[model samples]
Target: MKAPALEQRKLLDLQAADNRIAQLQHTLRTLPQEVRLAELQRDSVAARQEFGGVNGELEDARAEIARVEADIDTVAAREKRDRERLQASSSSKDIQGLEHELASLKVRRSNLEDIELAVMERVEEIEQRLAAITARRDDIATEERLLAAQRDEQRDRVAAQLEVAKSERSAIAGGIGAELLALYERQRERYGVGAALLQGGVSLGTNVALTESDLAQIRAAAPDEVVLDPDGACILVRTEESGL
Candidate 1:
């Protein structure tokens, strides 16, 4: 009976250890810093993508403006050449050809000017968008840095807690008797709850309660009998039984 009582206490200690270990494991698995860091990374990626797209649009607009300006310059040069041809030509047919060429050049210049104005407007819009994107990217980068620091701090705290739990478990295991410890370990392997307090005439830790007949059987055993409740059924521990 003394051995069984001792075994029961040892089982209680084991249960405490298991609960503490589970708590530490849960903290490690669901750290808030980890979730925050993942969100920060996702936001940073989106910001960078937006910034890149804006910059691409800006570059395209500038390229178009340059092309339009070059076309305008070509038309102006053609107009100057045609005007000189008109002043030097004496034949009516040659003058008419020069006039026609000048008319075509003027139309092309007007078209090129309109295109240039549209390209300038597009450039302004792209620059505004790029600036906004850059500012947002910078803000996200700052937030990410802060979140990374927080994550590191959280990891350190969890590590410290795990160490404390491990030391406490070792101390508890060392205080228990060897025979009692062995029995508790065996039961723990088979059942999650190794031992429970018989409280209110009932097992306090088991999912189900022991029946009246089972309690009567336990009471009928010898005064020194070592008994265990297995799956809500009572079992008398044989004196020679080293492990159960």
Candidate 2:
């Protein structure tokens, strides 16, 4: 393909813009906030699960305490009724029996109260744990929000730069002939670079110097000639440094 020397240089500008856009995309995908956000999400799930289990245990403890207190109240009432009947009775047997029954009830009430106390302590511990888990989850949520906002801001900046780069690429492409532009695009897809500077008798794309015959051939060609690498990897755009 034949492209004027100036038009060939435009390929470099287009390639630079393409490279910047690629970098921007890569930056968006691999932002540090993205990794941290993923970790926080996993932690948030685990924290919620722990909070749920602790909350269930706390409820059970409270229910058990209530049941124990009710039993204590019922036992106290029974003891009071038995004492009243014993005071009204004239028989010694009835009085002794009431005394023994009252002692047993006292023991049972003491055991139940002990259990209630234990359950109350357990409830307190569970509440503390729940609170701690809730706080941690909230902290994670806050950090996630902040980081997400920052990530979005960074992405917006990069997006703006990409739009400008795309505009520049479009303008540069418009200046080149259609056939040359098509070929450049194809070669760029294949080799990452569509054209290279011919400098110091070398194709910069391959970093290999041209032989005496090749140099003579390129020198004999027109100023607007498009030279291909010996390996045909890319087009060579001649410059003053071509050492012709």
Candidate 3:
């Protein structure tokens, strides 16, 4: 393979751009906000379940309270009717029976009121729990929105960087001759080494120095010539810094 020394140097820039693209792609795939969003989904489900349970219990408590109040009203009405009958009747036996029935109704009404009070207290507790659960859900939603906004912003920045890198690589590739470009691409695809700097008799690709015979061979080649290191990993580009 033969390429001008100047053309060979541009391979470093192309390689760097390719590395930038790879890095940006990796960032897009592993954003931290994505992981947090997944966890929030699970948290949302658990919160919903707890809220449903508490709400159902509150409803049951309300129904129980209504039933108790109804029972109290019925007992009060029965006592009023008994009192009316006792005042109108002159018979002693009827008056005595009415008094006993009225006494029983008062006891039943008192028990129903107690039951209603207890159930109202329970309903208040359940309502407090539901309010707490609702507040937690709101917090989670707010966090999710914030994280999502951050994720989108980061993704846009990374995507823009990737586009710029690809454009730079394209511009560099356009300047190189077809034969040289093909050779560089082939070496890169085959061994992940497209070009290496030949400095002080060393190939940067493998970070190894050449032997006496190998140095002699490269020294004999033309200044415009392109050569590979003994390891044959990459095209070695030389300059005054090569210390030839």
Candidate 4:
């Protein structure tokens, strides 16, 4: 198709705007904030798991301490009953038996006290662990929130830039003839680059390494003209040099 010279120049601007839009899209997809937010979310989940485990352990420890204390109270009550029974005994053999039972009760009470001490120590340790885990979880939650906000802002900015780039690309494309624009769009879908400048006789399109025939065709085209073919090749002439 024979587009006017002015329309042909607009093709270059269209190509540039399209490239800019593509770059913006790439930046949006691969933003550092995207990766960071993913990692932060993972960490937050892990922190929550840790906090849950710690809380469960603390609860278990507390329950265990309560159980041990109850057992101690029961044992002390039995010892008191045994002492009262000893005081009421009158026979020598009975007195002897009562003294032996009282000695055993003392040993049992010592053992219960030891167990209670150990349980208390465990409770203290669990409390400390729960506190630490809760603090860390809170910190991670805060960081996740901050990162999410920053990521949202970054996404908004990228979206705005994308809209602007799209508008610019559309305006430039509007300046070209419909046939040329259609050809360019088709080539872009096939090759990822709609048109490339014939610089130094080289047809460069989104890192498209040109074949010999492609190079020859570009070299043969008149300056400042757009060329298209069915093989998804689109070239814009810029110079007579045959080696670009």
Candidate 5:
């Protein structure tokens, strides 16, 4: 494939733009906030789960406290009735039985009260824990929002840069012949670099010296003539650096 020497050099511009676009895309993908955002997201999920568990425990503790208090109330009511009966009855046997039942009810009430106290304490502990966890989770949530915004901002900047690169590449590529441009694209796809300067008797693409026969061929070519590398690897764009 042949293109005017001056037109062929435009491939370098296209290559540079492509490289810049690739770098910008990489920047978008690996933004510092992206890593931190991921960690924050994970922490948010775990915090929610922890909060849910603690909330459930708190509810259960409250229910237990309520149930125990009700039991205590029932026992107290029974004891009150037994005490009244003891005051009104005259038979020794009846009074004795009522007194015994009142004593038993009193013990039962005391036990229920103790259980209620314990449940109430558990509820308090759970409430405190829930509060702490909630605050931490909220902090993490706030951080996540800020980081996400920063990440999006960085992405937008990189995206804009990429668009500019694309525009520049398109304009530069438009100046070259379609057939020549197609050849460069094909070589770029195959070897990652389509064209390079043949400077100081070396192929800049591979930083390797050109063979003697290749140098002879390039020297023999006319100005504005495009030449292929001896290895057929890339288009060699010659300039003052060609050492011809």
Candidate 6:
């Protein structure tokens, strides 16, 4: 394929733009902030599980407190009934039995109150623990949001740069002949570089010095003639610096 030497040089710009596009795409896929965000998301899941277990304990503690309180109420009511019977009964034996029964009720009420107090304390402890966990969860969420925002901002910046690069590539590519552009695209698709400078008898695509025979052959080609390097990796565009 024949393209003016100057037009061939534009392939380098296209190649550079293509490289930047690939790099930006890679950055989008493997952002450092995204990695951290993923970790934070996992941490959030674990934190929620921990909080759920602690909350279950809290619910159990509260239920126990309710049960204890009910028992204390029942005991107190029994004591009141026993006292009323004592005041009404004149028989000494009856009074003694009623007073003894009342004493037992008092002890029962005391025990129930103690149990209620302990359960209440347990609830308080669980609540405190839950609060701390909740605070930590909030902190994690805050950080996740911040990281997400940072990641988005970075993506936007890179996206803008990528658009610019694409526009630049499109403008350069439009000026090239269809046959040459097709050949360059094909080479790039196969070997990653569409064009490279043959500087000082070297193929910059591979950064390898071409043999004397290879340079001799390239020098024989017309200036507007597109030629591939010996390795066929890319079109080797020569200039005065190529030392041909």
Shift in Å, residue 133, candidate 2: 1.0
The superposed Cα distance between candidate 1 and the true structure at residue 224, in angstroms, equals: 7.5
Better of 1 and 3 by TM-score: 3
Off by over 4 Å in 1: 1-7, 83-96, 218-227, 232-244
For each candidate, give its TM-score against the true structure.
Answer: 0.76, 0.89, 0.79, 0.84, 0.91, 0.94
- Which is the leading candidate under lDDT? 6
Off by over 4 Å in 6: none
Q: What are the lDDT scores of the predictions, listed in order?
A: 0.73, 0.85, 0.86, 0.74, 0.86, 0.89
Q: Candidate 6 residues 113-142, lDDT tens each? A: 888888888899999999999999999999
* Alpha carbon RMSD to native, model 6: 1.5
Ranking of all candidate structures by their lDDT, best first: 6, 5, 3, 2, 4, 1
Give lDDT: candidate 4, residue 33. 71
Residue range 1-244, candidate 3, lDDT tens digits = 6677788778767767767777888999998899999999899889999999999999999999888888888898898899999999999999999999988988888888888899999999999999999999999989989999999999999889889888988998898889887887888788787877888988887899888899899999986677876887878878776778
Looking at candidate 1, the ten consecutive residues that score lowest on lDDT are 235-244
Cα shift from native, residue 149, model 2 (Å): 0.8
lDDT of 4: 0.74
Candidate 4 stretches with Cα past 4 Å from truth are: 88-94, 206-225, 228-232, 239-244
Model 5, 1-244: lDDT tens digits are 5678779888778778777878888897789997888888899999999999999999999988888988888888888888888899999999989988888888888888888888888999999999999999999999998988888888888899889888988999899999888888888888877888888999987889988888998899886677777777777888888888
lDDT of 2 by residue, 14-111 (tens): 66777777787788778778989899999999998998998899888889988999999999999899989988989899999998999999999999
For model 5, the superposed segments whose C-alpha errors exceed 4 Å read 229-231
Candidate 5 whole-model C-alpha lDDT, 0 to 1: 0.86
Give the range of the ten consecutive residues with the poorest summed lDDT in model 3: 11-20
TM-score of 1: 0.76
Model 5: worst 10 consecutive residues (lDDT sum): 223-232
